[model samples]
Target: MDLEVVEGLVTAIRPAANPTDDGAVLLPGLVDLHTHLREPGGEAQETLITGGAAAAAGGFTDVFAMANTEPVTDSVERVEWLRAHAPGDGAARIHPVAAITVGLDGDALTAMEALASAGVTLFSDDGRCVDRADLMREALHRAHRTGTVIAQHAQLADLAGNGQINAGRAARATGLPPWPASAEAAIIARDAVLAAETGGSLHVCHVSTAASVDVIRWAKSRGWPVTAEVTPHHLILTDASADSADPVNKVNPPLRGQDDVRSLRRALVDGTIDAIATDHAPHTRQSKQRPWIDAPFGMTGLETALGVVVRALLEEDALDWQLLARVMSTRPAQIGRLGPASGRLPQTGAVADFVLVEERSPVRVDPSRHLSRSKNSPFGGLELPCRVLRTVVGGRVAFEA
Candidate 1:
């Protein structure tokens, strides 16, 4: 599986006569609308180069790096600065998300129009919810004006107070506080109306609740530009991870029950959910080794995301490859405004950005082999039925296994 890339565009895929998996099962390059390349700080957890390599390993050509870094991305200057600092040779392309509010304080709005001018297509205070409805409304209005989307983390602080796992079983077993499903649904309900009223696009990040799926369905029914993304961890794992007593499973918008997983799958299949984002949050071993309640909320996902998705969605025939391409690449590219450069489908004259997926072979996820600085993966040691053999960008082999 080899190709050529010139000036960041794929030019050819050296054709083979009846090329099998050994040759390539070329699909559009994956695009993650929610990746956290923790650069500009937290380099111990992940740097631009390391994170991009992880994305490439997962067959991604572009990843939107969340703004929850040392200095939140809320200004035009910071957006430009991040672009200047992006990895020059990594296989995956990087698009930095800007914070909706200054410092993500949930109070003041950032310079949305200015940041948009600086090439920010998505904005969010992802680690924390934009708690104020008025503030959220203003942000929605501004996003409408700027032709961008306001992505929200969607957890009510009061409802998620000290919550360690899912509100029902895991929380009861662990005796940690509960993060009720209502906490997430409530925010989505409120924001959907605001997005509708403001005629702005609202992208719900890391959607984990069945109730949230209901809201997204209703919003789309009303023709509002509301989209949602689900993480591979959420699709495959559940609060049962708490049973393992591993802090690596502790993620914000904690894992839910099987019923919620079913709902999310149906939503994704039926197009209620728009994309599959990795939310590839990275954390150092020391940080994730802490108690579940004290550890940070995330895990390195770029490398294992596709395998999980294939196991959960494709193996059971719940969806097809076209839908997979839509969720993993096409839709995300549309949302990020990446055009045909990063997520174009494989074909003659197509942007040579694609991945070779070997569906017949199963492989276990080896955290030790990850390109990410952090090895905190929920899928560690778990075997999936399919593997990404190579990721190509602009005709160049960005990753090969």
Candidate 2:
């Protein structure tokens, strides 16, 4: 196949018209709606530079960096610093999401207008939900005026406090406190109402339960402008694996039952879930090696996201490639409000940002091969069918396998 790169924009892509040709499976570069490139504070686990490199290797041409940093990205200066200083080599573009609350304390709202002026398109108090309903309502009202999206982590602190795993038979068998599915569903339900009332865009991050999916579907049916994402881990694994006591299997919004897993998969296939986001929350070995309850709630997902999604969903014919593109790239860009102007493949005059995949190649997931500072993955040693051969950002080769 012949591809023309015109001034860092993909000019054209068409069939070579040759039978024995190695045709490249061209896809719009993956855009991560959720990512934690721990910088400005948690550099011990990850930095913007290293995280950008890792994203490029993972075939991502753009990523939305969460604002749960040490000094929260609640100010315009910090957002500007992240956008300007973020590493770029035709690699992934890093767009910072400013915190919704000051210092992420859930007390006062951040300067949404100032941050929006600095080019921040999204706002969140991720890693922790803004539990105060009044505070969240006010933030949503302000965000609507600023044209910024409010992405909620979707967990009720009081209900989820000290909870480790999904509240189900599995947690009961293990004698652990349950992180009730209602904990997430309740917040989504409430947020959907708030978004409807405030006329704001609401996005739920890393939705884990079947009930939450229903809430999002209901909200969307009402034309409330709500979007939701599911993590790769939640799509592939479940709490049954948690019985082994391996911290790698542990994560916030902990793994749920097989029924919930099936529901999440169906949601992805049926458009109930807007996108598949890699909540690529990386933690150090020391942090991940702690007792299950004590370990930080996250795992490395960037490098393995596409492969796992393809294997668990596409490979099984649960979803087609077009749907994959929509869920992984197109819809995410739309939800993040980065669509037409940025975060899309060049269609004539558009910017060049995309990835080429060797769909038949096998994936051997290994920490040593990953570019992130931490090496914690539940998919370690799991072989997958699809492989990313090359990634292009702004018409430049960011990664080549």
Candidate 3:
């Protein structure tokens, strides 16, 4: 296949005169609905430039950066600052997500209308849930009016207080505080109903439990405005991974058991889970080097997400490249309101954002080679396939291998 490009757009798709018989596949650039480009105060962890590089390296053309930075992206000024600082040379497009509540305190709503007018399509108090039911309901109603999406972190602080790990054998074995599956499920249940009640679009982030999948399935069964994303880690890693006193395994919504992993994989393939979002949280090595209890909950994923997902799903024969494209690109673009039908295939007049990948022997993950500022990867040493050969954004090479 040959793509004719002119001025950052695909002018035509024509058959090559002499196609090289390489095993490489060309795919639409992946889109990530959840990524933490920790700038402003957390520059020590990650910044826009580094994070964009990581995204491009992983075959992503677009990323929705979460609004959990130092000053918090609750205002138009911060949002604009983020847009202004985004790399333009040859990096993935960065969509700045605005916080749902002022200061992410969950006490009051941010200027939703104002932020949406500034081109922010997704709102969330990620890393912290909007625990107040009244506030979430109102936010959902407002989001509906603005034609935006309300993404929930889906954790109940009260129920998940001081939770250190998944509430099961891992927690029992490690003697750590247990984070119950109900904590995530309960919030999703409430928010699904609220979304249905208010006719608002609700997105569940990093779904990690079978119970949560069941709730999402039920919500979708009702045809409510509810969609969900599963992270690469959650789809592959079990809470048993946390059984060893490893802080790298610590994460929000903490990893679940193998049963939950199986359920999540099934849900993704069965269409109950809508998309695959990285939730690519990055933390400083110094912070992560502390005691397991004191270290932050996160892992850098943008650089390794595609490989991890490929390893997780290909084993079941449930993931064809088309399905992978849907979960990674098409569905996520739709959820982020990138376009009416954003993640389109390369065609006449389409934006030239796509990737070339070759299925290769399993390659062990090495965080030291990551483009991100932080090196808190949970998949280090894990062998994964599907090496990205090239990534293009706006007809320019963003990454080449």
Candidate 4:
């Protein structure tokens, strides 16, 4: 189909010849619910400029930037700083996620009402769980009243303390501390109840274990206002990385076994999981090159997320384009409360935020070619399907390959 753009709006849509000639598929630009732009503090790893470019390259139009920086995004001042410094219309829009707790300390809640008024639709203490039941309950209450969401990292620190890899055989083989699946599941279960009692929307970020899936499923069955997201890395990769002991595979809520990977896929397909989020954490090369036990946990995903998802779910016929749109775009947009133009289908008079994807050719993952400042992709050197041909944000071409 031919889409005509005028002044940043899609003016018309008409069928064109050979729409499938290049195996081209146009989709609403992807929306990422979880992304770490690393600005205002960690610019050595990434900034709004580099991170937004990477997000556009991955076919994303809008990304909710997490609140885990040096000073922490917990105030109206901090959020406005992010908004003022975000990239121009040529790049993906950055929606600032405010910290649920001051400095992400998890002891005291941030000013939720003030932050919401400042345009923060999501709150989180990501990289640190709000483990205090009193604080969690109070935050949920505020989120419910403000009509925003609380996105939890969901790991009990005591259970996950010093964990280097997934628990069980993988941890045993690597001689690293084991991270129990219960650490995640237990927190999800607790938070789900808090969400229900407080009548607030809860978003579980980076659900990694099969046990976590079961908890989310149960919560949804009970009609709680709960949603969950799974990362592409978690859906496609496994704890087999324990054998390689590569720090690139080291991530928070560390990669789990194949059984968990399969469960995450099934949950995504069956509507048990609402979205696919890239916890796009980036680290400096020096920080990432440290010894396994001392190195930071992260993997750059903004440039490779779409291909990883397509490779994980397409071949099995588990997801068609429409379903793909929901998990990758629409649902995430809803969760983040991004405006109407963010995740809409291609239509006349709509703002053009979309990507043209070439489905026939697969691209080999290369960290060096990525737009992100950091090169820490776990999928490096692997071939993946669906290359993004072009990304348009507000009718402006942000990236073309």
Please list the C-alpha lDDT of all candidates, in the order they appear. 0.86, 0.87, 0.92, 0.91
In candidate 3, how many clashes are counted?
Answer: 0
Candidate 2 Cα errors over 4 Å, as ranges: 341-343
Model 1 lowest lDDT segment of ten? 15-24
In the range 289-399, model 3's lDDT, one tens digit per residue, is 888899999998998999999999887777688989999999999999999536867778877888888876567899999999999999888889878989989889999
| Candidate 1 structure quality by residue, lDDT tens digits, 1-401 | 45556655656657554655554456788999998998888899898888889989999988899998888888888888888888775368889899999988888999898889888999999989999999999999999998999999999887877777889888888887788999999999999999999998899999998999998899899998899999998898888877666888888889999889989998888999999999888888898888877888888888888889888886457757788888998999988888755566665455567788887788988899898999988877899878889887766778998
Pairs of colliding residues, candidate 2: 29-354
Q: Regarding lDDT, does 2 or 3 come out ahead? A: 3
Off by more than 4 A, model 4 = 18-20
Candidate 4 is scored at a TM of 0.98
Regions of model 3 farther than 4 Å from truth: none
Better of 1 and 4 by TM-score: 4
Worst 10 residues of 4 by lDDT: 15-24
Which one wins by TM-score: 1 or 2?
2
Q: Using lDDT as the measure, which candidate wins?
A: 3
Q: How far off is model 2, as Cα RMSD?
A: 1.6
Quick one: best TM-score, which candidate?
4
CA shift at 208, candidate 3, in angstroms? 0.5
